[model samples]
Target chain A: MTRVRIDLFASLDGYASTTGGTSDNPMGEDWGRLTAAYAATRTFHERVLGDTSGTGTTGIDDSYVAAHFDGIGAEIMGAAMFGLHAFPDDPDWKGWWGDRPPFGTPVYVLTHTAPRPPIPMQGGTTFHFRNTAVEDVLAEATEAAGGLDVRVGGGVSTARAFLRAGLVDHLHVMIAPILLGRGTRLWDDLRGLDLTHKVTTEVAESGTIHVTFTR
Target chain B: MTRVRIDLFASLDGYASTTGGTSDNPMGEDWGRLTAAYAATRTFHERVLGDTSGTGTTGIDDSYVAAHFDGIGAEIMGAAMFGLHAFPDDPDWKGWWGDRPPFGTPVYVLTHTAPRPPIPMQGGTTFHFRNTAVEDVLAEATEAAGGLDVRVGGGVSTARAFLRAGLVDHLHVMIAPILLGRGTRLWDDLRGLDLTHKVTTEVAESGTIHVTFTR
Candidate 1:
């Protein structure tokens, strides 16, 4: 089975973005740390943003992230990942990465309103939108990925739907050392589930703590 | 007047936790980064966790987070923060923080079946639960704070209630660098609300990105 993995950025105080989705605050010191965390991921860092020009850190940290990204076959995301162009009438908004998006495989987006025909980006990446449940999207991603892994990209809400449907296989979180007093949070009303896993912790050059869990 | 801020930790895919309230794949490698982000907040990080010896990064990239915290006099969280104890027959569970939680002031929890008496802890922390609306709790926190700010700590559904009520004044976010593929999301049905705030970003030493916004 192609395991599904998820990647995200969050605040210590537990917010993913400003309530309005604007990243223009001088008050959040945590998000910068999140960016720095991405900077450390090296491969995924460079691959997702298309800046593969440098080598990453040594030791287990880089190896882990690199291995994970290497095993992934496709990527899944939400409309929020492409910015605030979710609605149909909104202006034609692409992604923050310009015409050449970073994903090398097929990327499926979960949405309801705006529909864009499959868009092929520069880096051998194709974007597909699925208006159905996340489970269906996962099935599509799994089939498209062949035997490789599938990565679930986030905007927050999209991630939640899959979790609710219980389709995820593995989760990877990097804790930056800052707090966002507000914005979108990652964990909210979960109280009845029990998760069993092992935790490994690593410290990066930029002070990012890389912890890995396997269940 | 007390300014109450609410914070949530959500997956990039948008889960606060699994629908069952369990964190996605405890064995995954993502939360470590998120915890690292929490460690980056120099100001309240140590103090809140009862660690007074480390000097991790402090302050959010956006001024809005600090401003929100600065204006608060107290806090209001849901029974979820107290863990399974909040259940109908969980034996009066305290929060995950144990005795002497990190809060520097009084913290009020919204519940219907917990202890009617307030429990006090070290660092001037206390937990009070009452069957009332969040606004009512915020009002009580404000009065208890005596000119400080009030904060609404979250569990998901509680935070949504406040946002749906349009009582929030600011938001801050720390976009982590991991994903949960599935879990409870922060924004489930928060559509059509206008977020009229400017955002600012700051990268922290721990690789967490901090963002803040003012409404």
Candidate 2:
């Protein structure tokens, strides 16, 4: 069975994403602060950032970061997450992930501006646009995953959509020990979520709490 | 020198207080769920609930719960937290705590409807209503503490008031592994709080994360 997975970084205040996204500051300074611990991990350095010097942390946080990149055959993300809104007019513009994107698999991008030809980048990564329902897109992603896990790369709203639809199998959230007062909160409509899934928590050496919800 | 300390129970969504508070359910069902871990602690059984049988948890959570009952000389809470809103007109209302309240020290109640003579209940628990500013009330509570730490007991708004005034020295929030969806959030308008105070996080055995902001 192909499991639908998602990983989120939120502040203790429950903010998942903030505004003010530019080409330089893709996800805002608050996102940087919330994901600082994850970025400090060796897995994040080797995987997402392409830094293989092995100068990053190697503790509990690194384990989670390593697991995040493991067995993810396909990815489903929102148009906002793909920076479509940022580079709306530019047809040639790809996502924040450069020409050689880290995701070495088919990435389904949810957008109303679908039907656009799939952009197959280097390293076996292909960006497929979809305007259909989340369930339909998820079906394709699950099939495209080829028995592996389908990672739901998010921008808060997209993650909540998948969660509200009860599609996520495993949800991991890293809670940063800070307060980001204003942002799109992650837990606004997710009530009694623990009742549906088994919840577990671990304290990382970087003072971040890793909470996982597994169905 | 008295330190202003506070302990709050919040959902992973940062909800501190929920609505639907009545005479029976003083703080609502969400509050109960958020504080289930704390309530299961041995110290909470003896101190707050007054359960002498000692059939409670004695783990990492119990240590924090035990510390909550230590060196608390006086407590400052809001009128709503004292259940004044539930019984606004009842002058005979002695608050939620029975004749023998858990707090053995002076309890300052912040209310615009103050000047009501101090009501001294059994077990040395005095309810003093104050219509003055938070700083003034905190000063009075600090003086009343005599040498021990003063606790800024909360209803979210009350705690935020003290925190906004930069009067809180230690703030420990128990983040329950649940999402309440709707309630009065705890971390609103508390931007960059971690910059002012040292933030530390620890995961309890009950899947709850205890985050402390110590200045």
Candidate 3:
């Protein structure tokens, strides 16, 4: 059976990235601080940044970072995560990911906008737009997976929407050891989550607490 | 040098205990759930509850619990934590502690109520009411501690008051895995705290996170 998995990064106070960024730094310095440990991992360097130096630390954080890319058949995300808001009228927008995006699999972007023409990048990655319900989109992504697990690649709001719908089979959250002290909270409105999923916790070498919930 | 230490229990969403409690259960069910792991430790039974059944898990959670009781020279807390709100007018309210409190040293209760005659209890415990600034109270508590560590035992607001005043040298917060789905947040308004202090995060056997900020 194919599983639906998700991975998220949060600050100690459960903030996404409300450090008040400039126009250039939209996610703000808090976002960098929140994902600093993950960004420091060898897997992150090799996979996301395509840094083949293999010089980043290969500790517990890297293990999770490596596992983030393992055995994922397809990916699902929100339109906001795809940077569609920045260029809403521009159909030429190829997303924030350059010509060669890290995701090699077909990615389903959930948007209220009309389902756009499919954008197939240089890699095997093809961006599919969907304005349907999460279940409907998940069914499509599940079928597209052929058999492997479908991951809900996040932009916080998108992942939370999937989680609220109880579509996530496995959720791995890495809470970095920093406090943004903002009003935007990540864990709000998610009550009794532990009752449905088996929650486990582990501390990474970089002082990030890895909290995983598995069904 | 006398160090100031504080230990606080918060839910994964950063709520202390706002689960709609009764007069008897002031902190509500969230408090018990938040502190379940700590209470399950052998040190808790031996020290607080006086249960010497020799039963309880001895894991990462227990190590912190064990350290909580060690080197604590004096304690400071708010009047609400002392349960003074329950009996505002009654002069004979001998606190929530039955007979002997776990604190062996003098506990300074930060209150506007002018210094009540010191109520010395069993086990070298004395209750002293102080109407002064946080710095003044800490100085008095530190001096009373005789160069030992002064602990700011919390009722959330009290600990936060000390934390805001930059009087805390070591702050250890246990983030329980449960979410209350409420509005009260714990880490609000404490921005840039990680810049001045060293922060560490550790996961416990019970899925609780131990986040420490040390100066």
Winning candidate number (DockQ):
2
lDDT of 1 at A169: 65
lDDT of 2 by residue, A77-103 (tens): 999888648876666768768888889
Best by lDDT: 2
lDDT of 1 by residue, B5-64 (tens): 665555433555443333444323444544455645554455565556756555442232
Mind listing the fnat for each candidate?
0.00, 1.00, 0.88
lDDT of 1 by residue, A1-215 (tens): 68887765554434555453335543244445455656665676566655567765555446656765677789998876755553434545556656877678899977675366777788778888778777788889999999998988776777756655666666555645454445666655432212443434454555444544445
- Which regions of candidate 1 deviate over 4 angstroms? A18-30, A48-61, A86-93, A114-116, A192-199, B1-215
Q: What's the TM-score of each model vs. the native?
A: 0.48, 0.96, 0.95
Off by over 4 Å in 3: none
> What is the lDDT for A116 in model 2?
84
Tell me how each candidate scores on DockQ against the true complex: 0.04, 0.90, 0.82
lDDT of 3 at B209: 88
Which of candidates 2 and 3 reaches a greater DockQ? Answer: 2
lDDT by residue (B1-215, candidate 2, tens digit) is 78999999888887887877667776677878888898888888888877889889999899998888789889999998786487876778878788888889999999887878899988889999999999999889989999999998887899999898888999999888888888887888899879999998998888888999998
Instruction: Output per-candidate TM-scores for chain A, rounded to 2 decimals.
Output: 0.80, 0.96, 0.96
Q: What is the DockQ (computed on Cα atoms) for candidate 3?
A: 0.82
